[model samples]
Target: MESYGDLLNNNKVIFDDRNYGFWKSRMKSIIGGIDRLAWKTVLEKWEEPTIKDEKAIHCSVGRKQFELIQGCETAKEAWDILQIQYEGTSKVQSSRKDMLASRFENLRMEEHESISDFSSKISTLAQEAVTLGENI
Candidate 1:
């Protein structure tokens, strides 16, 4: 139930291109928490809420990241650019998905590894796969 103002004062939602997956999720949660229409503006066509949503995204990114979407007219356009930059094109995504599947298939706990450590490794791989639009 956080307000838009609360998000403005929070730095945790900022994107710096280091962890695009995490940043994207946080941004979606914050924007959607404020209003579902605002989140829709980033996914659907441009609308009345686009300006505010675009501004929120524009302000939350670092200088380098800002430059990537400075010319974008809508939040959705900016989001698409950022996604492509980090996630790559569909072909690249397919390659990554294949690699992740291979890793998952070959993944095995080491003899000395703790159960928690092994679980974490599996979770990380699963998250990365999910981030790439894979069901794994």
Candidate 2:
């Protein structure tokens, strides 16, 4: 009986790196054991259009890279998947930074005005009230 790794080894050329060979063979084994529907599900999950966390982008990108190294049908498709994931993650990070900056600016403006402006207004109001009461 031939293992899935043997079949993949027969089909593709092995690289010089032992660790790379092990993972490529492992991925091939997993991919080969499954039916087409299961394979499609796995690939779809790896290339899913949505992301919940920044770290998910790394997984998606890594999957694409592994697929490319394992000789996918289309390199461009793998690249496009990686690009989309990276873009989405970057956008989220950028939006978070913008939100933080806006909050900081608001806090700075409030701090600059609240203490000095309130004290000056209170002092002026007290002086005017005292003057009016004295005249009366």
Candidate 3:
């Protein structure tokens, strides 16, 4: 059997509209979730009794989400934000394996499953990230 990365790199799903849409929606949802988490983290550190310009904060967070979603910067940054967001999650305390497993649950599922599964899932995700390159 061909590997997941091989299939992804081979353009197996490149022309599939449904798959594309699914990935797009999934990515949007993931980014939104991450953004909200990050915003909450900022809130924890924000010492103000109440936010005066909530609209500005929302807009700024939205824009940052856009940039990160669009792949304007390195995946390392996105991953960092994800870690931060996960840190702010209600039950998650340590920013370690448990945290990553909780945050990227889907991705973590294949970690101990199979190389093919791991490679394939990651490959498709990487492709999605690449798609955001010019849009950022």
Candidate 4:
């Protein structure tokens, strides 16, 4: 998620006046923590539903996650909080990818789950691998 976010950010795909809605909505759709950002914009001040939804997302997180993301004003802030907390910096993310590569290579289908489920699991891992700069 962090890698993908960085990829998009590096491409200048978000953060523009024209792209604010597009980037945020894209983030909400594609990124995990970013999804906590509200989709609907209300005319009313602060938008009750938005605040409620953000609070719910925050409250559901663990203490560590909460501490990292505490006092976020928007979903983008929360998303950035988690990314920093988990990945620290881009250099750290590279190291993390190196560490995970071997394990990812060893990924296999478990017998207990159905093939579809197992495929889903591997496909998710594969996507993560791709995110981490691996070819497989």
lDDT of each: 0.83, 0.40, 0.40, 0.53
lDDT of 4: 0.53
TM-score of 3: 0.23
How well does candidate 1 match the true structure, expressed as C-alpha RMSD? 2.2
For residues 1-136, could you state the per-residue lDDT of candidate 4 as single tens digits? Answer: 4563453444333233232334433444544333343333211134344324454335435565667667876555676665555545888878877767766778787768899997887776666655445656
Q: What order do you get sorting by lDDT, best first?
A: 1, 4, 2, 3
The candidate that achieves the highest TM-score relative to the unseen native structure: 1
Question: Which lDDT tens digits does candidate 3 get at residues 14-82?
Answer: 212234334334434433344555344433444343533222212223343534434413333444454
| Residue-level lDDT for 96 in candidate 4 | 70
Q: Worst ten-residue run, lDDT, model 2? A: 52-61
TM-score of each: 0.85, 0.20, 0.23, 0.44
- Count of backbone clashes, every candidate in sequence: 0, 0, 1, 0
What ranking emerges by TM-score with the best candidate at the front? 1, 4, 3, 2
Candidate 2, 73-134: lDDT as tens digits = 33234434443443236566466455544543444334557787866655544433332221
Off by over 4 Å in 1: 49-53
Alpha-carbon runs more than 4 Å astray in model 3:
1-16, 19-106, 134-136
